[model samples]
Target: MSLYKTEAIVLKYYELKEADKIIVLYTRQHGKVQAVANGARKTKSRLAGSVELFTYSDFLLYQGKSLSTISQTEIINSFASLRDDLFKMAYASYVVEVVNEFTVDEEKNEPLFALLLATLYMLDRGEELELATRFFELRLLNLLGYRPQLDACVDCDLDLAKIDKVKFSSKLGGVVCADCALEDQYAMRINKGTVATMERLLEIDYKKLDRLKVPESTRQQLAKILPNYLQSIIEKKLKSLDFLKTLTMTN
Candidate 1:
């Protein structure tokens, strides 16, 4: 058919019949793309390095009837450091997994693409990995139109700053004031500190994540809350998250 080129980060890959591999990528221009890397499993295959998970690369693709084929590739940033550390790799995998699971083929989302790239860069460079992951989750939710309302009650629309006790309702999708909590029986009590942390994380730039200190209690609160929020949004448990929890517990 036709040939095209674009910048992409390899999300994941699976072995194909014989020496080929099926690569899932999130491209800067094309959103998510699935393509075949012919003979990629073979030792001498040119696509081997370019198609590895988390590798940012430029690719030449051949448009086919059912799937695109990666004809040529050049490495941009392999994010080599992620491979050197188990924890970093696990976090990175969770990031990519979120991108891969939530996105649809060829759905162009530049902000999402940028967020993923920036997050990977932070992970690779050894920045605040935990904060970065939380920030990414919050931002990703906003970008995808699932942003939780933190400033006010989801039901009554009252400003949370004026409210003394605020409860977070994952079912209602945001903070609920004391009066509104009765309406949402499943609302869980959220400490003011964790609420503040979430608000700050949502507003701060990704570049400054390392500068934002999260107290152990706040971090634990976030570690509990954000994943539950994300799981509620996605409606299923993330496999990578299970592995990440295992890694965290072991370490």
Candidate 2:
């Protein structure tokens, strides 16, 4: 029965009854929260626009025994441009969906929230969407304590520079050189440039992601492969990720 205020990003929502809506939000202080917004489905509801997916809002919430209730919400930034374009919206949805998948209730995840906000801002401003998405994925993995190794071989500790075809092993959490990968059945072929691109992405800031120059083939490869790698670790396919692919196909 205590009321609290916080800045939050609406991840997803669903209609609950004729007038109420259930909102899933990732807050700055509170990791991920599920709350019911009474009357939010009505045409004139004060929470209508503010509760939309991917919108950043300042919310006044009341704690309940089961789920919290959002008493009021004010839009801080609608990120209106993200909604205006399909590419932006699709990528933004991917980011939100991944966040929703990785997190649980009432945990303070400041780093992840900041990364998502920065990523959404980059997507909204019309940056290179592909690069932004990949970068977001890498950074998100790092924040979640599952950072993949890119420096050297996990087995012999050999530098990967001299290798031609690097072996990326999900079991080992990164690239293992050709020699080391020989013994491991779980390793897969990873291009040198792709490995380099992944390393750069891990270190670069969101503001400079557009300046990166990765080839289309490399980008496509990473885009296809990285998610599968992540899925191995995360143990589930994100629904929004599938929707994003479908949106791209139909467009």
Judged by lDDT, which candidate is best? 1
The lDDT values for all models are 0.89, 0.86
Q: Residues 1-251, candidate 2, lDDT per residue (tens digit)?
A: 99999999999898899899999999999889999999998899888899988999999999999899999888999988887888898899888988888899899989999999999988888878878889989998888888888878877778887666787877677888878887778687778788889989999877777788999778867877677678778788877778787876686
Q: Specify the highest-TM-score model's number.
A: 1
Residue by residue across 82-172, what tens digits does model 1's lDDT show?
Answer: 8778999999999998898889999999999999999999998888888889999999999999899988888889988888888888888
* Cα RMSD, each candidate: 1.5, 1.9
**Model 1 misplaced regions, further than 4 Å:** 182-186
Write down the RMSD of candidate 1 (Cα, Å): 1.5
* Global fold similarity of model 1 (TM-score): 0.94
How close is every model to the real structure, measured as TM-score?
0.94, 0.92
